[model samples]
Target chain A: MVKRGAASCLLALALPAGAAEFNAALMVAPEVDTPNTASPYYVGPPLVPDRASRQDLELRLREGGFNVQETLRWQTIRDRTPEQHGIANQFYYDGELGDGLGWTAGKKLMSWGVGFGFKPLDVVQRENRRLVNRPALVGAPVLAVERFTADEAWTVAWTHPGRGEGSDDFRDASLALRWYRLSAGGDDLHAVARLSHRRGLEAGVGATRVIGEEWSIYGAALYERRTRRLMNMLVGNGGTLAAADPMSEQVGGGGTKAVAGAQWTGASGWSTLAEAWYDADAYSRAQWQRLDALTASQHALAGIAPAAAIAGNVAWSSQAYLTPNLLRENLLLRLGYDDRDGFRPYAELLATPRDGGRVWTIGAAFEGNRQRLALGLRQAGGADGSAYARAPIRRAAWAEWRLALF
Target chain B: MSRRLAALALAVALPASAAENVAALLKQADAFRLPAESVRVETQVELYKNGALDKERLYTVYVKPGRRSLVLMKSPSEIGQKVLMLADQFWLLMPESQRPLRITASQKLLGEASTGDIASMTWSEDYDGVVEDEVDCPVPPPNLPEATAPPKPRRCLHLDLAQARSGVTYARIELYLEKSIKLPIKADLYVGSGKRAKEAWYVPKPIEGQQRIMAMLLLDDIQPNRRTVVHYRSIVPKAAPDEFFNPAALVRNSLSGW
Candidate 1:
């Protein structure tokens, strides 16, 4: 139905003389990398010892007409590791009417998914490396694109994971609305409300008010009524079987949780965040009686565990321009400490993809009229006495270069 | 020493008469402002790229006050490409399907023919002076070769052609006025863009009982970086209907026949 409607609109526009414009680009990249020797992220099983590496060819095309634009991209790597050899293609179709009503439909990554908002798309950052867990349904048209005059915009979108065979087809979608406002030369209120299909519901609200031109004070609170099934899906079934379903056993039972955090931005290019969370999953009469001092306050920053856990984290990112066109450098560093004392397997699995322990990265990008080059190094390791006590640290580095053709 | 002082005073006083006369003439010319009502002109635009002729288009220009003017293509047997120049904006009505697309001021006007800025007709406001022909003289050198006979004596005057200066007329221009008639017979225009200067001849003829200059040409030999020659094949003043200059009128007349 949508395709037919779009076709008729194009026909109407073509009744008169039509103008066509085209733009195209081609790219070739060759890379070589070592094999992974540590335990894979999914399970504590032996990792794939060695994998072959190779390069690929990519092409992009854009066709613009009176009021429509169509873009298509193709990428294929013939000789890659067993896990990496897959064709990655994306098609984007967008049209803008004279009245400002525009539509976009294609196979692009949906950036509004759970735990996906703050992170770049997997293809862009190559976070997971493996391509089996990619989102389905390609891309769908859901809303109209328009310019906003307000200081901030809160966008919420929903998705469904489709149906399954044994399990009730994972029916889930997440709606998150975040407003990042700018005031007094600094960031202001940045509130996020996320409601997912699996998790009963959750709300996180944050507010930041500028105290000076270069400094701001901010606070955020999170409340959640996590569904029991959702926890089971994450922790997997715990058993002695060598190959049992990893998502069957859930530790934290269904319960209510309240977390509060405070962070200061513009702290000399460094931000310090402190948060405390309490879960009433293992409820006891005495736990409610000692709510005031035990469930909240500055003790969270002193490395004291709330009923669940409290953590203090510091993160910093800075960029330096070496020259106008010859060189540029970027650095990212994060360090955090959590108070608790058990090797929580579930936490090790979910927390890192979320809190993502300690990470440091250094990258440089260089470009000229003829050639371009970029190199990045990353090291992510966490020492969680409370979880994954023996998890090995992981590190990786990559570099890419391209030549321009006119 | 007193004799030298008297000579200096006479030299300084010589320009006083010319300045006063030029200022008075400007006052009189104010009433002769190009009628802001409407104009129908036959024009040709020659496009040049890298100092070579690329393409040329003959057009019929219909202009109106405070509204859009339409320039319809008439040459190369191409589709009727219409360009509309409104008061505050400009647009192109593509004849392919009569789509009205807003054009940027920096785009080439007609297939690289001229810069869009020159088509907006705002160039005339950049100059400020008025000089009249106070004497009859032959056409200047370097324009008409010495081997060619001087057509007739014309009244010529030295005018300040500086741009935007208090008494300047054109950025760079020189006028050779007809001795008896005050109309300009020839003009030399030195464009600021890095190109050779251009000279145009305005040969007048009586048409429909009104005196009009119908012949015009741009000489590109001076500046090899740009080249173009335009000839007015036909012109009909006040021939365009009143509705042709409207923005909506252009859209309405676009897909439909004239």
Candidate 2:
């Protein structure tokens, strides 16, 4: 049904207007990387592919105050492969309604916040899995209305979760409003408020200010009143057996997350950005230590007792202890140099200060007449019991080539 | 016979008449340029490296003087991309991102064209000019092709310019304007070290129905074999709403109809 609708829309757009524009690209990217050599306690997959391929077809159409975009991808890793499609990368109709009012409706990609590596106020589509090497963002459905002047704007939007295989519930929809202003000194200031049926209320403020000619500082902070599912481990039979359950808890008092950063660009096209992020909901140092101890106990039990019951308990415990974004404080630094001859060299370092773990990547991209090539190396480093030390893939080297087709 | 007094007297007396003449000349020259209040222009840029075509880009520019300007990219790879300049601040709005990202003036848009170069159109406001001297056109080089030959001994006015304020791209410039039309013919940009860094030539062409003239600017890096040519495809006298200069409005304007 979705495909049929898309085809009909494309036909209508292509046929009706003489001003319609069409664009398309075909990209085939293949990569080879080293195997993972981390501890067994790591939750993610241990062995990534030594070879993988991804081919993507992207198409866009614009006509009669409407725009539509689509992407189809086929990827293979070793012997396993999957086909994925995004019907509406961005399908929106926009027009002015006189009196400084404008409206846009359809599926679109939206990004909020001012951090290079992390954004706290970007709640919509926040759960989408992102790759560090490739930073494409998925789009969401929305209907937005805005009134704007040369330096100020007020906007309201109704947002819906992106189309995919997910549980459909009230939580998948939300209403958001934003007010933005530009100061005489060229500072961009914005305030956002969102209400979700399942998550209650969330509000945030963000600002970006240019300092002098070479420096800029930006930051975003959000406070949310929502319920979180926390893990609870129960010990029974005088501490000899254990079971894990998820407990729902309401967190409303000052549960905030913030990201602040600054950037500097030199006259020679060298730029650097440094950012720091704090997630109040993330695991603290003591909590991480406790989880680490529990994992170690499970590992010891699995090694010592090979019985079926013991193995099952260890597996369950391992699953229970797996957490996402476990660290509280993180710092990111990015540096890049573009010589404008199609050669760009860049590097990024992400450090979890609380756990003393870090992930560092260095890459270079070269653009040819009709193709692009990128080479990169990534490494995770930390002491024992740290997040990076337990990372599934500790080191990797990759190369990607993209040939443009139009 | 006090040297300081004499120097001060000369400095005060020399600029009164020269300044008046320069002001008149700059005002006349401004008439040949785009309207400073509000205007829309379509621009195409072609980059050449070592005399080979490197890249091409098209853009639609909307400007409101003393307020803000927006440059929207109209090309294959970056169709709905825009850059908004509010006062001294610059922001890049990509189609995939909801919020505009603050950027530096040094960032390149296409080839040697920086975002600063495309956003700014008024030169008389940023620079103060003094009439240097009058000179005849230089003789054509021996190896120059007939088609590339210099114009025959046309009267020209040479002017030296200095920055009226800080943060401009060039610290000093030497400009030559055709005396007849007050059209800029050539400009040599100098860096802080007083060394010529780039040379630009403005070639004027008439619009079909309009009295205004549009110019094609060719910029050459002082280092040999690097050049960028910017063609003013169209410059229409249209007044954009003040609301259009805002970053949010600029982003919204990039969708659909534009």
Candidate 3:
């Protein structure tokens, strides 16, 4: 049903774009993963795909005040049936009421925030940064009114309209406001506020200031009234394993998220960035240790308990790895170089210091004429007992090629 | 004794008088590129390697007062990308991210063609220099990538310029302008390290009975075999709204119509 609706919407994109700008591109991406059999919670067939081949046709159109951006995709994972999907990346309209005031209505890819590794004031989009070979983003539904000036701008938006709490962050309805000011000395300042049922009141401020010609410093912090995370009921409990599912959602009181970073670039086309971020929603060291204890105890009951039940519980625990970050505190260091001739290469290291877990990745992209190619490789490991050391996916590599059709 | 006093006074006045003349000359030289304070310039850049065309890209630049410029990428591969420069501050909006990102001076130098070279057309606002010498206009070499006209003997003004403000693409430039008309002809571009980086030559054409710069040729010193030619397709007076230059406004696509 979703595919049918998306296909119908995509058909409209091909309709006469007379006097309107039109562009399309085709992309083919393939990813390979190496699963760790030594992982205590590794799940085979149903839980993971060892390899995937994906192809997409991306189209874009702009006419007057309306624009459409969408991608049609087909992918096959391992031996599974090939899946077909489509996404409306951005379908929006902009109108002016005069007097420097404007309104936007539709699905829009909008983000009012700062920071490289993480954006604290991204209340509407709430994107997870630093994913390898990620697809184009789909915008959130928004109805917004904006006021603008030469150096300042204000926006009030109702995002994910008509949806209520209990939905995911992207789908939850919320009222958010973003205020931006360009300081006299050329610094960028941002403040944001959001009122949502799920997270309650959320507010944050961010700033980016350039020092000299090569160095830039930025930081942002957010305060949330409430935060929730899904955790296993077996954690902190004496039960070795439950016949039924033990996963439950836990809500906590006030929480905070913040990030600080600096970047430096040299005239030689070499750049480096160092960033540190804290996300309270991620599991803490204590939480990971407790979960680890439970997993160990469950393995001890393998003979006593039903083999399927034990395997099921362990598999459920692996979901912990689904989150972007495994620990509360993360530090990242990256170095990149652009040859100024369309080739860029970079390598980065992410460390979860509290648990001594680390992940490293290296990537490069070369763009020529109407063609672009990118390749990347990632690995996760650190201390022997760290969460990353026990991750099911030990290594992954991906490559993608894109060509503009017109 | 009266003759000695007269000579001393002339020397003192000559330096100060020459300083003012250079400022006026620079302003006049700027006019060859900009007919008005705010205008839209359609530009196409072609990169050549060893005299062979390598790549091409198109851009539309809206130049407003107060050292602000908004450049839109009009090519197929880079469509929907924009760079907004407000004085020393800059922001980039890419279609994939859909976010207004604050970019440093070095970040603006990324890509094959620097955004600064594409958008920035006037140099009087960013430079203050002195008239150094009067010399013959340097003719293009026969081995140049573009076709050259017959050489003609013409006097030119040699001006040595230094950056008056940060964020400008080049730190210092030794420029040569047609002495009689103050039309820019050629320049030696230098980086912050005081090292020669690129050499530029300007080509002027008749526009509505007035001579205006229509193309610029760049020869890179670092990459000896590479040359870039920037062609100005059109220039029309257009006063884009001030709101369009705001950093937060970089994400808005409605400006495509403007």
Candidate 4:
């Protein structure tokens, strides 16, 4: 059924009239994973996989105002069954409702903010920017009306309509409004607001200003009525182990997210970026310490309780590793160079200052006329007993080869 | 005594008259590149390394009266990319993220920084200078591609120009124009450090019974082996809507057929 539906969509995309563009890509990505054993949360053969690889074929077609993007993915993991699925990344139609007014319907990517590593004003699409082997973005279902002038634009969208809330914030039904204006001095100013039952009301403002010939700076801040995060119910209750997972999503009071960054690019092809951001949804230093103590107590019950139960509890506690940021405050620095021959290389370091946790990544990509190759490697480290230091995955490396078939 | 009196009169009025002449000359020269007040230019760029074809790209450029330009990348690899230029300010929007990013001045360098630089260039608005001398037009070096070179030799006016505004791509330009028609012939581009960066040649062809710049050849002085040939496939006098140039509108997939 998946293959049939995808093929039908591809045919539908090609049948459009008036200057249609059809492009297809064939890509193969193989990844190697190195799990850390010294950490208390490592799960070896049964639950967690040792390695994984994916092969993908993506098609994108655009005609007049209609656009469709669909990808077919097949994956293999060590000691696990192969998985296959079809993903519709973006499918939307944009048309003019009247003079200077526009309307867009269907699923589309609507990302807004002013940060590199983190974006505070992305109320409709809370994208995690640092994911390894980032997949194509799956747009939110929205019906948006927008208007633009020479220097100003405003958009009001009903996102995920009729679907109240799902697993995360991206699937929540909400009304989002974004107002953007280009200041007289060339500064970009933006204001965004989102209203939803899951999180009540959220609002933010952002600005980007270019300095001299080689520098640019930007900052943004968002206020939320509620922030939701998973917490261990028995962290301070002094429980050795539990028969079931104790982690559950809990809603907290109002919180704030902010990011500030500056970048400089030189004529010599070298560029540097320095950015820092605070995420109110992530765990704090004190909260990590308490979780660590709970995990230690669980390990002490290895002989008293069933080993499987103890292992499961520890794995449940490892959920902390899944958050976008390990701690609230993060600082990121990146240095990159474009050789001007379609090759670009960069090195980046992301550090959580409060807990001294760090992540180091290096990557390079070369793009030819119709082919692209990318390779990257990342490692986690920091002060002993820090959240990143005790993470399950210690290092990862991957490579991708993509060819455009038109 | 009459000749001496004429020379004295010339010396007293030269400064103000020269400024006006330079402005007029620049406007005349600009008409060759931009044939209309608002135009849509279909351009193709060919990159050559050591006289061998290395890569090719296609761009659709929309230019307006107020130094505003929007470039759409048409190559397969860069299908959804766009660059918006509003005078000294520039923004680049990549297809993957669909977010507009403010770009620094250095990132506006033609060919290397962004294609929008070369796609939209007008000297009358960005530079002010004085005509220095009249001399024979320089011939295109044999290494340049043929269709883009001037066909015959003629007297030329040598102009020395300095940047009149900040955030411009080049700080200085030594321009040479055909003395008779004031048509631009060659330009020596310079960087902020007084280093000659690239040499550019303008190629004019008859379009609609009038001579217009149909092609451009850019020879890199810094990288001796690199050369870029730009061909304007079509230039139509059509003005896009003002709202399309807004930076925030870059993400909308609605610019097609505009």
Measured by DockQ, the strongest candidate is 3
lDDT of 4 by residue, B143-183 (tens): 67544345566888778888898877789899998887888
Top lDDT model: 3
lDDT per residue (tens digit) for residues B207-255 in model 1: 5565554444444434345444444444443534443443323323221
List the global CA lDDT of all models: 0.35, 0.65, 0.86, 0.84
TM-score winner among the candidates?
Answer: 3
Could you tell which candidate, 1 or 3, scores higher by TM-score?
A: 3
DockQ of each: 0.02, 0.47, 0.71, 0.57
Error of 4 at A275 (Å): 0.8
Q: Candidate 2 lDDT, tens digit per residue, A8-105?
A: 44664555555777766666666665544454434332223466777766676777657777766667777565656445566777776876898888
Two-way TM-score contest, 2 vs 4, winner: 4
> Candidate 4 lDDT, tens digit per residue, A268-387?
778999999999999999999999888888888878888888889988988888888888999999999887777889999999888888899999998877788999999998989888
Q: What are the candidates' interface root-mean-square deviations? A: 21.3, 2.8, 1.0, 1.9
Pairs with backbone N, CA or C atoms under 3 Å apart (clashes), candidate 4: none
Clashes of each: 15, 0, 0, 0
Fraction of native A-B contacts kept, per candidate: 0.00, 0.52, 0.74, 0.68
Chain B TM-score (model 3 vs. true structure): 0.91
Question: Candidate 3's residue-wise lDDT over A261-328, tens digit each?
Answer: 99999999999999999998889989988888888888888788887888899888888887767888
Winner on lDDT (2 vs 3) = 3
